[model samples]
Target chain A: MTATLTAPPARGDERLARQSAFSRLAGRPEIGALVGAVVIFILFFVVAPPFREAPSIATVLYQSSLYGIPAVGVALLMIGGEFDLSAGVAVISSSLVASMTAYQLSVNVWVGVLVSLVVALAIGLLNGYLLVRTKLPSFLVTLATFFMLTGLNLALTKLISGGVATKDISDIDGFASAQAIFAQSFDVGGVSLRITLLWWIVFVAIATWVLLKTHLGNWIFAVGGADASARAVGVPVKKVKIGLFMTVSFLCWFTGMHILFSFNTVQSGQGPGNEFLYIIAAVVGGCLLTGGYGSAVGAAIGAFIFGMTEQGIVLAGWEADWFKFFLGAMLLGATLLNVYVRRRAETRK
Target chain B: MSLVQLTGVGKNYGNITALSGIDLEVGESEVTCVLGDNGAGKSTLIKIIAGLHQHSSGTYEVNGREVHFNSPREALDEGIATVYQDLAVVPLMPVWRNFFLGQEKRKGLGMDSAFMRKTAKQELLDMGIDLRDVEQPIGTLSGGERQCVAISRAVYFGAKVLILDEPTAALGVKQSGVVLRYILQARERGLGVIFITHNPHHAFPVGDRFLLLKRGRSLGYYRKDEISRDELTALMAGGAELEELSHELDRGGGGVAAAAAKMLEQESKELGITPGSTP
Candidate 1:
């Protein structure tokens, strides 16, 4: 039977306008982080005299750039509603492999980096496959990978360095070439910033584009949101989940190689506890643990906040040990705030 | 020729027989009604035809061609579409998106966003559903609206034989009325409709033939012109015994309640309500 009530001609436009208004008013986490970043910067500038300097701000962004690259990958995975605790440990594992292969094995840097990436991707794929197949919690699977890779990092480093903390790649054939590309700095407004900041920006742009503008990005949200519904409608749930896991792993390797090439030295203890930090950045950036909803740029801004605070605290003449306490406090506060923000946005509709 | 045929079909879960010795047929452009009580193999018949379950014995045919379907995808490929009570529509998604879910249009190396929305709107409007906003979440629509959207989706996908398990089972009078209209519309559009419902009244008006089932065995199949609605309802409710039971209830509880009960019996008798008629 035909419905007696027909929709108005302007109905589609009205609904779209309403949705856009809701999104604008709800303020996605990334936008919140941008606002928070300004607040944090203003607070630090007012409290610490040196923080107002262009050189000091550039230093914070330069340092933030390093952690920011890994955070972008972490955020994408988190948005898909999975975790990779192994990422932190993988950093050192991948860096050590790349450095040792290049300096110790006398291989080319690119070849060494490729080997490291292959290993990381393998771990990620195995972890994702097991998680999807068994339907087990990701925390346990990635935790196991974290410890296993952590052990491998130490064992391999010791095998090559003979009990040393780090291996010197200073005289390696490609050391200068690698350093020029990864570690080189340029003067901008009398403040020298590492080239890694540019890498961080590119990562943020690409990650944001994929999450918002592409079909793969849509699947990422659906896979994390309600997998059963996604599968019922014929979305390839398992394949998408596995692919996201591998993306996280590959990104971790990429960031690790960036560090190795920048420093011309590799240490065994490089990335051990950094996984938690990356997760913290993502959380502060407005990602939900429950999956299905999050922002990639929010996570980048989250990394920026951490980067600023880490260097900002020192600029304010505070003891570095207190940085942990500050980070813990911010993560808890941001999570609580994110929960409130998300609940309001969802319920408003 | 039969569009779908099931002969000696049976299904078992461990030791429990969900269906047994089922013989059925659905012809092109004709509505076939399959009636049975709960646990009398109604679900089993639908599942086997829907490709959700396979038959353990006998053969299933489409267009007089014997075939086996291993999955629902295979069934759809052969033009047999099953619409369940739940409808499989994502509530949060827009109507247009849900309509073309797995079969979305693509353009310039990506999903053709404009084309999908435009075609979905046109399809619904053609079905007499005047949706002002195709972008509103499908969940916001009433139950009748949801079923209409689903029926339109099935019809648009080129289903040659549509099997509705219990379309009106969960609906109110007005809502069921809406669905019945859509079924008749589909029939007029030339697709064979398998109207599986216990309600003979719902089937009597539209069905071309009726298959009376009791305890997993077919009582008989009768052409619509040969059987009256009262006789079909009587056969469906186990005939004269139920009429005697209804008459007995009125005399024993004769009061204000008896008056209401008598009124209900009169309505039931006049409308020829059957097992599938009640909620």
Candidate 2:
């Protein structure tokens, strides 16, 4: 009976090996993003003369890192079958907390940063808790958080600083060290590379490792695939989801700190629309909105594409408004490509 | 001693009685087949035994000690693994990942991917399931192969009593045969198996004991030697009720319903059951 069900012997082992190898490469979640990045790079390199320069490349990398850091977290959350619509306002909220607390209390910048971290994590926990306990859709829960945070960010900033932006904290104690850690740039082959770029690489590396080399990685996939089934098999569904939301909050705090210290001031309305960019990067990186299938590295590559396009259009003398159109196209195209790749991989078996 | 035993076990949900007066014992190296049609409280019974739900009244024992499980985790800790019909597998996840989903091997804060992949492949092979690649998503496998994976996962996890819920209900004849073979292999390995199904044809050959259920109550439990396959099928289909239906259809003749009734009468006769006989 087993012999009858086994694969045909007529297909040589060598052929089977080759087929699997090809399928594996094609099946990778990041393959679409990688290809998109390469195409965007080539297109910009051909059309934008300045894009070929090292400094311009560094600038693109810097911009990519800004979105790449959070996109990694968003990808993981999405893979776990949840969304954080508040992610955008959450970044601004964190920055506002850090800046306002530093100036209002006249405390060390590091102390303000700590306060901001707590605030961000609390919001994330609330999102996760409400999602699990109320059994509400994550989209609605986070959307509510998004609106609340958005309102608070603006109102609190105005109330505290009497302006739409926080007071500059560049002269506060520990500000220099914080800047060095988060916002400082170093020369790389005569082109100054922002430290955020290094942070982005580290973030992507850690997120990728977690997704591929940890039990939590398996849980994320399982929970996203089928929560009830995963629970039946002993996977802690609620904990994984809560942890994922917290992970997003932690990333948002990091990004928020970077934004605050980099400029020494944060605008009250700076983060409202950026959440879509993070989601777009994840989707363009081949993450399905339905969840259970995606990669952190793919999201990183997706952000890289975003950075290149945003910079490429400016360098190529095209209107920056066209960037949104390009992003929309990429999202649709990447999703279609990912669907096709998944079908091919499954059918090969 | 029985690996798991239940006596006068019953469950109530508000005003409805889901199961009543169920006495079952699953021993080592044996298959105790629970035969039931839809709404026969099969799911409720398994949920109670698997610790998803507590029995409203009964003495449930594991290893001769009374036990009450609050959750499926407790049940698993007690080595009673339930492989649901859906297989409890993440469809989009790779085979190795699903195999070691909650129980993963770790090395220095990271999963031991190499070891997990190798062990998953070996375990599946040991269970006589051959896959082209363990890295492939489990959704790519056939329904039978997925069920086999779920069974192997339970066995690997040290389940002393394996309760399978309709493992063959959605499978084709060949796939059903494959799953039956796995059940036999599991029994040979000295694991007490509770094979739940409405199909007696699939159960009779592999089961050592048959427990027939109807309307949330056990009709009776029989050893393989105490009952013939025909008798088992007849009982599962409600022998007397089926006979009466055949006569009714015979009265409303000249249609497909009458034809089906005629076929039922022929089958009943072959099984040595006379029409209109007591159930």
Candidate 3:
């Protein structure tokens, strides 16, 4: 017979302890990043008078918007237990395709964006398919995708621009329309901010909601943590993993379209530097390289810190190269702190 | 009627034979104890029954109907659940979450958090897991508690037949008693239970039928009414081998007579040393 087996509810010091422990463990990643960002903020403002201006903050948000949106998607993919090395090249490829279609082939901006997304999706599907079907390490599979896309991006640009760095699409039929939507800027409190900043907030919100509130979220955690166990329990592991890869690619392509429309041109090496940045943001946000745990909001915070330092270093009259050094130190420190706190939370005494 | 029956089952792993020509039947509202030494095909048999591995040959029937399961899910879908020694549960999750890991209830495409928490509490309460807090990660619970949670989960998911793989091996005597009580509870609920263990003492009292295994082959199957505890234990340990061991461990300057007297005393104690015994 079915009997109601009830355990007493957690109360008193136990509940407090659990909450404190969780906050300490889960909060460390963001807290570390935030602290570092504040330190950088103070150092730059004190040393460089120009950094104190509200416009400087707008520039930071604008830069953060471009990198932040893709980082959120990358974080989810990482947490779900896979890699996407081709994500950077995917952005470049999508940007080029969007520009070529809307500016060169005289297609509608929306349609060009859609076509670009489809191409990216196909690449993601192929990557997910090969990795799962062949049982290859995802790192190797995505690395192959990265090299292939890199070659494609370079070859396509050279062919289209006749060995030039990029193709100009100022006179294309959809250029005006794309520019109207993506290139627009608004002044908030006397600070000019790109609309991409708004996009970043929306992206983070949606990504957060999906990570915490959906079945897909559970599968992502399960697949990344222990795929075999997840499969044993009847979770659709392959489908979830493939879906995550596709979402990552979709985000890359979406960001690429935004960049292409904002600048009205696309280059061969438009996104090569982005791969490391996405991973760094994810790692700093507390995503384990081994997978199964992370937060979209934390990744967004990591990007925010990156943006602050990217602009702050230059404004502080430091050589831009120092920014990389700062990032390295910040990443190492944040990663160690996150890993330590997470271990404490997961272990039972 | 039998809940599950394996007819002339055999299994081979590449060059190594894991099981050979085994026949077993489990009846409803009864316990079938499978006792074996290590590498004696105990685990292999469990895997076969749980649908983790298919038998190389033989027919497995549930409720008198032959069934083939391609995966564990298929087996579970047929109201058969397996609770392994380590227990398949995520320790870092709440007890309720572990209860409904892959089978969560959602409303309008989103997780109904309120409902999950409420039901998780109710279900645990229903199953008699008196936890200090359901919100605590399952890792904090004792091994016995965790095993109880797994058993309760199996029952909640509509299990008609439950297979426990070495469920008491990792537990202390007290903890083992708790699990045994739960097994009795399950049996009382009219569910057929398969208890697998190396400990014959634990198996003998609860089992309606005893199947002893050695070297991946069935030694024999005995109904509880037909065999005494000593006979079952002797057979399980390979009576001859155990006597050889007892002689070696005896190491007595007190002679064979003294050794014989000591062994008789030990045996009687094990088998509930009766009153007014004559040597």
Candidate 4:
């Protein structure tokens, strides 16, 4: 029983060398986003004089950090093949919970923050549990959650405070330290940088490591690419998906706390439209809506582009209404660019 | 002792019997080929052995000890791994990532990227697979290359019994030959290989034992020495029924059917079995 014939190698060294280094670089998902970011930067630097100032640069980074935090989470969740439509309202709900609980009960602000964290995690857990148990689309499940949280944020805020906003918590015990940790800004090189910027960098770094270097990261790609195939190979698909949802909620809670302490008050209607911003940033960063292909660093760059574009328009003395149109154009452009890059990469090989 | 043994194993889904009275054995370092046509209980048998399904009757023994597996994970824990036709590799992921998909090596709080890359490359090389770049996405590989990767991954992960579901079924002649070589390599490394296919030409080359299955029941199990390739093909294609179909076609029509019937008679004569013989 020794009639087996070995197959000749399909490729040779000459053919392998034919793949130029530049083509390989062009295949990366982040390359398009990176190029877009640089082009946007150069356009703003030349046209918007105020944007060239160091303090203005810091402000843009600060704004980017605010969106960057949740965008990083959204990028991971998107790569894992799901979305959290409630992410935006969930942030407001968290801040409202923290402000109202601390103001009404007169408890230390730290306790309110802890309670908000728990609530955020629970919402995430519910979203994941329902998505897995009912086998419904995450978009629908999170959409339902989005509406519910929006209603609750208003109703609960008004019910607790007589107005559609939480009472100011600036005078509350532990307010000073909470504000320092969440909202304080520091000066560096004659420019002020928000603490949120530091946190944003940390989030991006950790997420990039997880997506590229760990077993869970592999499982995320596997499950997102094909859940049935991943399960067949013994990857814990359900746990990975649930964990991604929870990660997104945890970031939402963190961002929500910053919003609460930065302003010392939270308006119930503040979070409804922000979820779209986070999704846009992730998509711009090269994460596919279909999942299993993306980078966290790309999401951060996407946020930076958003921040620059929004501020650049103001600096250029353009109407604020034009910002929405620019965002729409960028989203469409980035998605098309990403699709082309992916096709080129896959087909060339 | 046999690495895997099934005695009187059977399965039923309410009223439909998928498999029954299946007696099979696979010894270490031997390739036991399971031959069958479509809907001949091949999938059901693979599922049962791979722990995707439980046997409804009789016993399944591993190393002389009766055991039941509730999931593929459990079967993997027992050193039984099934490489499905789809290969279970994420197409967009790199070769090293797909090779260690569910089971990845870690260093500190992060994955050991350097170690995983080196080991995956070395393992493929050890299996005589020359991959130009392990960083390339698994989807870039041809069908034969992908099958070889799957086999090498199973071997590296300490799979004592490897169940391959149609590894060469979706490949060309040269690609199929490549997979047959890998199957022999796995057998040489002392793993019990269950090679399932419908092609006797593919099976007879490396198979030490042959189990022919037809419509949920075992037609018969024959050792390599007990069965010729012609006998195996005839049995798999329907021995007496095929002969009867040829005679019916010879009388009924001309052109394609008549030509096919004449070819069937020639094959039967070469096998020393007359076309009309019942048994």
Backbone clash tally (model 4) = 0
Best by TM-score: 2
Model 2 per-residue lDDT tens digits across residues A106-197: 99999999999999999989999999999999989999999999999999888889999999999999999999988898997788999999
- Interface RMSD, all candidates in order, equals 4.2, 3.2, 4.8, 4.7
- The runs of at least 3 residues in candidate 1 whose Cα sits more than 4 Å from the true structure, single-residue gaps closed, are A1-31, A164-166, A173-184, A319-349, B13-16, B27-47, B50-53, B81-100, B127-157, B161-279
- Cα lDDT tens digits for candidate 1, A249-286: 87788778777877667678768778888888888888
* lDDT string, candidate 3, A1-349, tens digits: 1222434554432434445765655444356666666777788778888878888888988888777888988899888788788888898889887767665566676777778888999988998899889989888998999998888888887887666355666666666767766667878777778888887898889887776676667677777766775675678888888888898888898788777877677777767768778888888877777787677877887888889888988988879998889788878987897778567546544
* lDDT (10s digit) by residue, model 3, range B1-279: 788999888899998899988888997898999999998899999889999889998899988999887888889988889988774666545566667777877778677766776776666665565554556566667787778888878888889999999889999998887788888888888888999999988898889998888888888888999888777766665655554555555655467756775685566456543333311
Q: Count the backbone clashes (under 3 Å) in each candidate.
A: 3, 0, 13, 0
Residue range A1-349, candidate 4, lDDT tens digits? 1112345435444336765888776777788778998998999899989989998899899999999999999999999989899999999989999998898999999999999999999999999989988999999999999999999999988888999878899999999999999999998987889999999999999999889888888988888777877887788888888889999999999999999999998989989888989999999999888888888999999999999988888988889898899889999998998788667655455
Specify the poorest-scoring 10-residue window by lDDT in model 2 chain A: A1-10
**lDDT, residue A270, candidate 4:** 87
DockQ of each: 0.24, 0.54, 0.26, 0.38
Cα shift from native, residue B239, model 4 (Å): 3.4
Task: Give the TM-score, chain B only, in order for the candidates.
Answer: 0.85, 0.95, 0.87, 0.95
Docking class of predicted structure 2: medium
Q: What is the TM-score of chain A alone in each candidate?
A: 0.92, 0.95, 0.90, 0.94
